[model samples]
Target: MSSYPTPTLATARLVLRPLVATDAEALFAVFSDPAVVRYWSAEPWTSVAFAEQAIARALDSYRAQSEVRFGIVLADTGALVGTVNLHHFFAQNRRCEIGYALASGHWGRGYASEALEAAIGYAFQGLDLNRIEADIDPRNGASAAVLERLGFRKEGYMPERWFVHGEMADTVNYGLLRRYWNERP
Candidate 1:
């Protein structure tokens, strides 16, 4: 039996579930796009091996019950779109961090927002978590906007927190409390 069978989260158009080895190709397609990863903490993946390694790590984390990463897919065609993750678990405090990515081809649509909603709902309800946090490059306006739309408030800013690909970037922190999420209109 699986240590943590990642529950499937579905909306009208998307399905979020645990990634399998077979998803490596689609996963590589999403992360290998420069446009999709421009503001990401890591640079674009160079090979399918990166996706394979990531799935390997995700599987290990799942078995250890340390992190939950969900692959976002289109419901109609079951095509991989992106991913949403809840990691850095502080079980004693009932808290974790949220992160997500989407293919550039799916940009301008509400896929990220929809997928995040499902993931956040799972974190708070299914996992019984109290707080979820996120830190993103301030230049990622779209990501900040999505977190805001999901009721995550900007909490702090850290300058030059990351030096990825020889570029220094500032981070804006966001946090959402379960009570606040419960109170959303």
Candidate 2:
């Protein structure tokens, strides 16, 4: 079994923790909303059952040696505000992909950025990753801004890279190396 500790990462206004089965309700609340999933997966969640299944998959990912999923909780209210993950961990390459989403109600508040910063810190300091990447829809200025604010440089644009809503969407790739993080203010 992997020895990764299930620890909570705290930011100024957010708490990042592993997803528990009991989080299904909160996950459903965020994911079932059309706005929240618009730029994420291909389809919006239709029921709480989908959230349950997703939670199950998250649990499985946690059990694996290469992935970590975290639920973003509001520090003040303790509400499940979003989710973030580090996946495709490459031991040989010392790299990983970072993905995140926040509830519609939580958007525009910097919660996603705060949660992502914590995740990045964990990846670099805790996991000793050398590089981190985020793939975002080309039109998602907010997400792009988050990556940029966190010192990720836009590396490329992949045309028709992801299929969403029955149409192929272009994706922008952003990446930050350990040296980049070290040079940040």
Candidate 3:
């Protein structure tokens, strides 16, 4: 069985941990909000039931060793604020894809960046990955900014790459290699 390092990751203001069934309600609250889902791949979650199913799938992915999904919690209050994940793991290539989202209420607080930084550190140092990438919608400036701030350089832009919210969207690819991380202070 593939095992992951423990679930708890603590940053100054945030806690990243495995998603639990009880978190479904809180996740639903954030995910079902239309404003939060505007830039996300799926439409607003219709109900808690949907979030429950999503949580189940996330748990399964972890158990199967296919992905690592963490619930982003506010350390001060222990509230479920969002999620971040490392997916599409290519162990042979020592690479993976990173993805994240936060509730509308938590935007601009640097929570996403902190959470991402922690995840990247785990992937590169703890997990021994050589590269990490973020595939973002070209129009999503906020996400692009997060990747850029984390030292991921924009490598390419693929036009008309995905259909999101009924429109074809271009994708900007951002990548960070271990060589770059090793050189950072």
Ranking by lDDT: 1, 3, 2
Candidate 1 segments whose C-alpha is farther than 4 A from its true place: 1-5
Expressed as tens digits, the lDDT of each residue in 41-106 for candidate 1 is 788999999999999998998788778899999999999989999988887888989989999999
lDDT of 3 at 129: 88
Over the stretch 122-182, how does candidate 2's per-residue lDDT look in tens digits? 8899988899998999888888999999999999999998888888889899999999998
> Candidate 1: worst 10 consecutive residues by lDDT?
1-10
Cα lDDT for residue 28, candidate 2: 92
**Total backbone collisions for each predicted model:** 0, 0, 0
Residue ranges of candidate 2 with Cα displaced over 4 Å: 1-6
For model 3, the superposed segments whose C-alpha errors exceed 4 Å read 1-6
lDDT of each: 0.91, 0.86, 0.86
Can you give the TM-score per candidate against the true fold?
0.96, 0.95, 0.94
Find the candidate with the highest TM-score and give its number.
Answer: 1
